[model samples]
Every structure is written in structure tokens, then in C-alpha cells.
Target chain A: GAGVSQSPSNKVTEKGKDVELRCDPISGHTALYWYRQSLGQGLEFLIYFQGNSAPDKSGLPSDRFSAERTGGSVSTLTIQRTQQEDSAVYLCASSLARWDTEAFFGQGTRLTVV
Target chain B: AQRVTQPEKLLSVFKGAPVELKCNYSYSGSPELFWYVQYSRQRLQLLLRHISRESIKGFTADLNKGETSFHLKKPFAQEEDSAMYYCALSKAAGNKLTFGGGTRVLVKP
Candidate 1:
């Protein structure tokens, strides 16, 4: 694709239910990132994937949140036993390189937990 | 640990006026700072980075180590500049980034 793509642009899920958000970064891009934005808040770093493996997982808020990228392309963020606080826009981005490079972002998936 | 801070939640300016958005950070190692903007209904995109030392759409940011500030500035603001701005910090240690709370900039015509 020309740009990063995210699935389920908007999602509504009940509290305690699980949710999965998908992201497909730009083709040939080597770095992928996940960020969360709460209502009226800044972007919060979640995890990063260099290729198909996540080398940085320290940003994950809690154990309930886990993510995986397969084939260094498609990535999925899974939130287990979702809480109301989990509701936020999940954005994915990809950069040409690992550092000091411009990153392109997806439109983001607006997750609503009720 | 690395951290980024955006001081203002909202900033409004008239067209052609000068605008500045403040960002501060805390990191022991050398830090790279970046400004990202998200226009209405659009994806967040890079406005500029300190390393590049380039200006986009007449916007510039200078990284001050002593003060730990990286503020985005524009000499002449346009209504099209209205957007949500974020300050991000990255160090050589890892691939992760620390972002500050965003500031919503509104440029009125």
C-alpha cells in the first residue's frame, strides 16, 4: 500500500471483552510503531516492531496488552479483558528507518469501550 | 528514562501572526526531538525534526539542550496550520519514543 493501513476504523466493544486491532504498514518500510491516544490527550507509545519481532515491549501499559507483527508487515494489537480505560484511538505508523526518520501514520482506529 | 512535555493544551492565533508551540524534555543522553501535526480528519504526520534542521510550511523548531526545550515556531501562521501538534523525543538507546501531551493549535483567518 502507499501508506499505513488500519482495520476497523471504529470499534465498539463491551468492557471485559477482548479486542484486536490490525495495522498494515507501508510496503518496504522496516520500522513499525503503535501509539494510543486517549480523549483529549497526547500520543502514548505502546510497542515497536523492527521486522516481524518486537524488540521494544516496555511501553505496553500492562500485561493485558500484547502485540505481534507477522512477516514484518501486518501487525495486530490485542487487548485482553478490556477495561473502560482501554478505549482510545489506536494509531500505527511506519518509518523508512529506525531512527531520525520521518514516520507516516494511519488514520487510526477509534476504539470505544462501553 | 526519557520524557516529553507540551505546556499548552490549546493555542489560537490570527492568520499571518507568529506562532510558537512549546516542548520540553528530560534525558541524560543526546536526544532527538520531532514535531508532528494532525490536521482535521487526517493522519498524524511529521512536521519536522531537529536533526534535519529543515523548515516545513514556514515552521521551524530549535532544540535547546540547556533548557531542554524544542519549540515549534512559524513566522506567519495560516488557517491551514490549525491542527493538533505533538512533541516527541527519541534517544539512541532504543526504538521507542516518548511523547508529550499534545497542544491543539488554531489559526483563525
Candidate 2:
């Protein structure tokens, strides 16, 4: 892809259900990131992946939130037992490398839990 | 832990007026700072980085280590410049990027 791509631009899920958000980073990019954008709270760092391995998962809000990247390319963010507060725009970004490089963002997936 | 803060939630200015968005960060080690902007219905894009010491679209940000602040400023605000601005910090080595609560700028004609 020319830029980072996120699937299901909009997702609506019921409480207690699990949802999966996908991200396809640019080709040959070695680093990927996930973030949540909610009202007032701003953009919260969720996870960081360096070549299919996530070294930084401290930003995951709770046990219900988990993510994984495969082939150092596509990534998935899964949320279990979704709550109303979980509704937010999930953003994915990719960079050439981890060290101080510019990150390119996707259109973002707006997940709404009702 | 590293954290970024944008004190203003909204900034309103008329066309040709000067606009400044304040950003502050809390980090123990050296950090790289960047400014990102998002226009309506568009994805977020990098505006400038402190390391570059360059201006973009008439906007520039200076990283002050003394105050731990990276403030974005533009001498003349344009209607097209109305967008949500975010300040981000990246630590040395391979570390996650932290973003501050964005500031929404509204440039009126």
C-alpha cells in the first residue's frame, strides 16, 4: 500500500462481543504502532511493534485489549467484551524504523460499541 | 515514562492573525519532538520536527529543553490551516511515540 491502511473504517459492536481491527502498514516498513483517539482523552498509545515483535505493550489499557503483528507487516488489535467507553477511533501508523523516523498514519477505524 | 501535554483544547484566530500552540513534555532523557496536523476528513500528517529546524506551511516549532516545551507557531494563520494539531515525543533508541491531547485550531475568515 502507498500508506498505512486500516480495515473496516467503521465498526459497530455490541457489549460483551469481541472485535478485531486490522492494519496494513506500508511495504518494507519495520515499525508499526497502534493508538486510540477518544473524546477528551486524546491519542493514547496502545502498542508498538518492531518487526512482528511488540516490545512496548505498557499502553494497553487493560487485559481486554491485545494486539499482534505478523510478517512485520499487517497487524490486528482485538478488544474483548467491549464497553461503551471503548468506542473510539483506533489509529495505526508505520515508520521506516523505530529511531526518530516520521510515522505515516491511516484513515483510522472508528469503533463504536453500543 | 514519557508524556506530552497540550494545554489548549481549542484556539480561535482570524485570518492573518498569529497563532501559537503550546506543548510540554515530561521525559528524563533526550527526546525528539514533532508536530502533526489533521485537516477535516483527512489523516494526520507530520508538520515538522524539532530536529529538522525547518518550517512547514508557515508553521514552526522550537524545542526548548530548559522548559521541556515544543511550541508550534505560525506568523499568519490561514483558513486552510484550521485543523487539529498534536505534539508528539519519541525517546532515543527504539521507543514508542507519545502524543499529547490535541489542540483544535479554527481559523476564521
Candidate 3:
């Protein structure tokens, strides 16, 4: 697919359990970003990965949240000890370059924490 | 700090009517603004960027530095154009983006 791809379109997990969300960005894109959208709220920046560079994790809310981009293509966002507040739509986006360019987004993973 | 704001949570208009979705941003440096749209059951996609200064699907947004706004406009609203629209801003020196709460436009025939 030409667009950014995300797995587990929907997930239901209990509190204290851990969950991992995956993202497959568009081919040849060098920059990827992760954001979370809570109900009726705006997108909250989570992390950013540039090709072969140190990721910008400033947006990450807590230590339990971590992400990695392997081979500069696919990325995963892991949340440990999931709390009820963790429920939201996790969105992944990729751009051909960096901030100066436009980005393509995926359908997003809707995680529901109970 | 960079911030984007969309005052209207929802806007409704009749088909063929002119429509405008307001977007405002607060950034200290050069501003990079973008308008993204998400149709029903679809992923959010870029609609237009202020730098391009191009009209997409008859939609155009003018970057107002003085007003600190980038309002999207279309001569005639179409049913297919109804979607959730978000306004975002990224400061020139940063990779992080600030997004607004989003505005949903509904076009009725």
C-alpha cells in the first residue's frame, strides 16, 4: 500500500497489561511520527523517528511509553502497565522528509483499556 | 510554545454554499501550517499547505501573519467534502507538531 499502515485496528486490553502497536510507513519515507488522540480531544504528539538518527522522544508522556523503528521502515509503540487513561486511537504518520514536508497518516490503532 | 486552535467544533452548510473553516496558530518563528482532512471511515490526509499556495479541490487557505489565522475556504461546499478537518502547526526549528481539536464540516443537500 502507498499509505502508512497500522496493525490491530482495534484492541481491548485490561489494566496492568502491556500492549504494542505497530506502524509500517510508506516506502522511501525517512520520517515517522506517533500521536495519540483521546475522545473529543486533539492529537497529542508521542514520538518522532528520523532515518538512522536519535528519535525525538520529548512528546512521550511517561517512562512506560517507548517506541522503536527497525530498519528505518516499520515502527512499534509499546505501553507498559496500561492504565484506563491509555485508551485512545494511536496514529502513525510518515513524511518524505521532515517537518517542512507534508505527512501521510494511517487509519490508526484504536486501543481500549479496561 | 507552538499551538493551533480551531474555534468551531462543528460547521454545517448547504450544498453549493460557500464555507469557511477557521484555524489559528501561535508560533514565535516562521510558521508552517497545514490543513488535514479525514472523511468518514478514512485516514487523515493532507488537504493543503500554506507554503504551496495552491487550491485543492477548490479549497484554499490564506496564511494571515497579522491575524495569526489560516482559514480554509471553498466557493461551493459539496457533500463529498464534508469531513473532519484539522489545522496543524510546526515551528521551523522543531519536529513536533501542534494540532487543533479539529472541526467537522457537514454539507447537506
Candidate 4:
């Protein structure tokens, strides 16, 4: 793909239900980032993946929020027992290198937890 | 911990008027600052970085280490420039970026 791709574009789930958001980063990009944005709020860093391993997981809101990347390409953010506060736009971005580069972002997944 | 702060939630400017979007940060080490913008129905994209010192689409931001500010500025605002702007800070070589609350700019005709 020419740019980062994310799916499903929008999801509406009941509270306590689990949800999964997927992100496919740009080809050959080694750095992937996951961020959560509340309504009219700044992005909250969730995790950062350097290839298949995540060097930073300190930003995850809780233990129920976990993410994984496979083959250093596709990444999935999973939230177990979702809460109303979990409703937000989940954005994914990829960069060629860790530094001195711009990150390309996906359209983002709008998650609605009822 | 590094943090970015954007004070304005909304700003309106007439076309051709000067515009400034404020940003501040807190970091102990040297920080790299960036501005990202998102237009209506579009994905977030990079506007400019402090290190590059390059102006894009008539917008520029200067890093002020003394005040820990990196406000985005434009001499003449355009309707096309209406968008959501975010300020971000990163470590000298860090992969993760700390983003500030975005400011929604509306350039009226």
C-alpha cells in the first residue's frame, strides 16, 4: 500500500465487550505507533513498535489494553472489557526511521463503546 | 516525562490576517518539536518540524528553548488553512512523539 491502512473504519460495541483494531503500516517502514484521541483532545500515545517488538508499552491505559505486531508489518490493538471511556479514534502511523522522518498516518478507527 | 501543550481550543481569523497558534512543552533534554495538521475529512499530516526550519504552506514555527514554546505562525491566514493543528515533542532520537491538545483554526472569508 502507498500509505498506512487501518480497519475497521468505525466500530460500535457494547460496554464490557472486547474489540480489536487493525493497522497495516507502509511497506518497509520499521517504526509503527498507536495513539488514542478522545473527543476534542490530543492524542494519547498507547504504544510504539520498533519492528515486531514494542520498546514502549508504558502508555497503555490498563492491563486490559494490549497490542501486538506480526512480521513487523501488521499491528492489532486489543481492548478487553471495553468501557465508555474507551470510545475514541484510534490512529496508527508509520515512519521510515525512528528519527529525522515524518510519520504517515492512517484514516483512524472510530471506536464507540456504548 | 515529556509533554506538549496547546492552549487554544478554537481560533478564528479573517482571511489575510496574521495568525498564531501557541504551543509549549516541558522536557529536560533537547527536544525536537513538530506541527501536524488535519484538514476536514483528511488524515493527520506533518506541517513542519522545528529542526527542518522550513516553512510549509506559509506556516512557520520557531523553537524557543527559553520559553519552551514552538508556536505556529502565518503572516496571512487563508480559508484553506482552516484545520486542526497539533504540537508534538520528541526526544532527540526517540521514536515516540508526545502530542499536545489540538487547536482548531477557522479562517473566515
DockQ of each: 0.71, 0.74, 0.66, 0.68
Ranking by DockQ: 2, 1, 4, 3
**Candidate 3 CAPRI grade:** medium
lDDT of 3 by residue, B24-105 (tens): 9888788889999988889988999988889999999999999999999999999999999999987765456678989999
Taking the tens digit of each residue's C-alpha lDDT, what string does model 2 give over B1-109? 8899999999999999999999999999999999998898999999999889999999989989999999999999999999999999998877568899999999999
Specify the highest-DockQ model's number.
Answer: 2
- The lowest-lDDT stretch of 10 consecutive residues in candidate 1 chain B is B90-99
Give the per-residue lDDT of model 2 (tens digit) for A1-114: 688999999999999999999999999988899999996557888989887454588899999999988777799999999999999999999988755779999999999999
Candidate 2 ranges with C-alpha deviation above 4 Å: A52-54
The per-residue C-alpha lDDT of model 2 at residue B72 equals 97
TM-score of chain B of each: 0.97, 0.98, 0.97, 0.97
Summed over model 1, clashes come to 0
Model 1 C-alpha lDDT per residue in residues A1-114, reported as the tens digit of each score: 889999999999999999999999999888889999998888888998776454588789999999998888899999999999999999999876666777889999999999
Query: What would the DockQ be for model 2?
Result: 0.74
What are the models' TM-scores?
Answer: 0.93, 0.96, 0.92, 0.95
Question: Which regions in candidate 4 have their CA more than 4 angstroms from the true location?
Answer: A52-54
Residue A77 in candidate 1 has what lDDT?
97
Q: What's the true lDDT of residue B83 in model 4? A: 94
Error of 2 at B34 (Å): 0.2
Enumerate residue pairs that collide in model 1: none
